[model samples]
Target: MSKLVSENISTLRPYEPGKPIDELERELGISNSIKLASNENPLGPSPKAVEAMQSLLAEAHMYPDGAAFRLREAVSKKFDIPMNEIITGNGSNELLTLAARTFACPGENAVISDYGFVAYKIVLTAANVPFTSVPVQPGFEQDLNALAAACDQNTKLLFLANPNNPTGTYVGRKALENFLKEVPPHVIVVLDEAYVEYADADDYTSGLELRGLRERLLVFRTFSKCYGLGGMRVGFGVGPTELIDYMNRIREPFNVNILAQAAGAAALFDQDFVERTVKANAESMVLFKRALEDMELKYTPSQTNFLLVEMPEADKPLGGAVYQAMLRHGVITRPMAGYGLPNHLRITLGTPAQMERCVGALKAALEEVQ
Candidate 1:
């Protein structure tokens, strides 16, 4: 069995997703648990998306359009990008994997922020493409300068997550623009903007707005966050036609399922729902920050729908213990141990009431764990 597995695959560590609410309830023998672990849109799916998906339930017998025509059309209209430059995926996760496999050859490698999305390392390694992790700056912001300096001719792909997960830190427009210019021409930059909709920062510029800055740049987005289509797994990438064409060559046929395609397209038109989701996230974020402040818990300033909260010192209980204690209180949060931040937790914003409950649970958990 050992000899059967590829050396790279054998050594690779699997990604641990957040515990699902149902699974937690079953294991803990509890009911009505609130999960703030996976950075999901607390509002759930859009009404228009539901209607569209329901209308297509009868067409389950037929395979999805392999090209994801309707969804691409909607994306194109929404972003003003051409259809040929858009590539759809099961989720943006799949697109990240595809970018790794399609661009990086055996000898070439990719580069990512140290605390960037874990999926980048997973996908790159799984594709047998080596990568370098550039350490984030003091504020947990991706050091764009260091990342640019780390790239050599062998660097084929560079993965950057704006409002990076597990930390919720972002580089502003000017910094991003300067960094893009500094990157070598041969390296293809993959900008993951999954949380772009929630960012109200004045200087935050989506990679979609800077697509013309680099010929090889690709901007990937998902309906999972703001659009509330996590279960449907709808994601799309915008890039030059040539690059997108190359990626499509290796893209799985019917990757975007029938229902997902319908749902994503409808979700695009439901701007009102997205606006409401953003508003709720802002309100909840403020409440959570205020609570954290009152508790003397340090937290990162976030431009997205989640907060990265630091626990007590290493001498005290860390994120894992706190997470477990919180679970006993019927609240599920993401522990940062796996991401090498053993003393921190990543909490997704819910409704204000939910945040208050979460704050109460956190206080109780701290008392119990400490």
Candidate 2:
């Protein structure tokens, strides 16, 4: 093997996505199984987006606009940010990678919570950059104070999930403002809001309002969440024009396909559908909480689309047991042992019917084994 390849590539562990419905069904030898594993919109892609993409499918052979013109303009207008401040990505995950490569270098480091979005950590490692992992507070909340304390002169990047994946705990606007006050000028913070549309708390930071301070803060969002364009693989980042412009130079010219560009632009205009998804998430999260409470299962109060349920000490591993049970019952949920939460599982908020079936399956699974 050529020594030209960086050793960083070998040590990196690949990301494990939520199992696909077909794969699960084929493995289990069943049909009509419901998936609550991926934090995807159970409502599927938006009608408007789907229609737009279907029309553009014939042009698939054509290269995508590297600039992602219309989609960028749509996102900029929706958030009231300048066109110059936005950059599109294959997905927000690629944006995270771009940040690590654009800002941090071999000797530099980034700061991330111990159990934050897996993408941030994965990206940092891929760039061969060192990072400090701050432990999440009890109930999986980001410990901003601890993270602040962890920062040193070598730290060039900071990554956080607004409503963290798996945990779904959010840092309020006031807290974020306070933390930003002390954030060093040299340190750039990337706030990943993959599920921002689902957050209902009054104190939740939209990352939209932080545009004025773009020099130090970059807000990442995706069409994959409430916008229902996950299949299109479209997402964008907002930051100070100065910083975003620098990252833009490194992006592939045809990174975003024409269909994704078209669908993303249309999805932005589908305001009513977006509202409905957000409303549904808010409503279903309430029912999920009530059901967990009724069953005496301890779970963190989530403002995001998913709920993280903590399991009790048991003979079998929490990840293996609940996952197997849910699979057996045709309800798929994510086990988060990879983020170091071996005792917890992350369940995405599906449709009301799906949630009802999932909870029932989970309860039955617990009963069957324990």
lDDT of 1 by residue, 1-370 (tens): 4488897899999999999999999998999999999889889899999999999999999999999999999999998988999999999999998998898887999899999999999999999998899998897989999999999889999999997897888999999999888899899999999999998899999998887678889999999999999999989999999999999999999899999999999999999999999999999998899999999999999999999999978685489999999999999999998889889999999988789899999999988878
After superposition, which runs of candidate 1 have C-alpha atoms over 4 Å from their true positions? 314-317
Give the per-residue Cα lDDT of candidate 1 at 170.
90
Per-residue CA lDDT of model 2 for 17-135, tens digit only, reads: 98888998999898888877778887888889988998998988888878888998898888788899899999898899899999886678999998888877789888999888998
Candidate 1 residue-pair clash tally: 0
Residue 112 CA error for candidate 2 (Å)?
A: 0.3
Each candidate structure's TM-score, on Cα atoms with residue i matched to residue i, is: 0.98, 0.96
The Cα local distance difference test for each model comes to: 0.93, 0.85
Least lDDT summed over 10 consecutive residues: which range in candidate 2?
206-215
Q: Identify the runs in model 2 with alpha carbons over 4 angstroms from their true place.
A: 1-5
Residue pairs whose backbone atoms clash in candidate 2:
66-253
Candidate 2: C-alpha lDDT: 0.85
The lDDT leader among the candidates is: 1
What TM-score, to 2 decimals, does candidate 1 have?
0.98
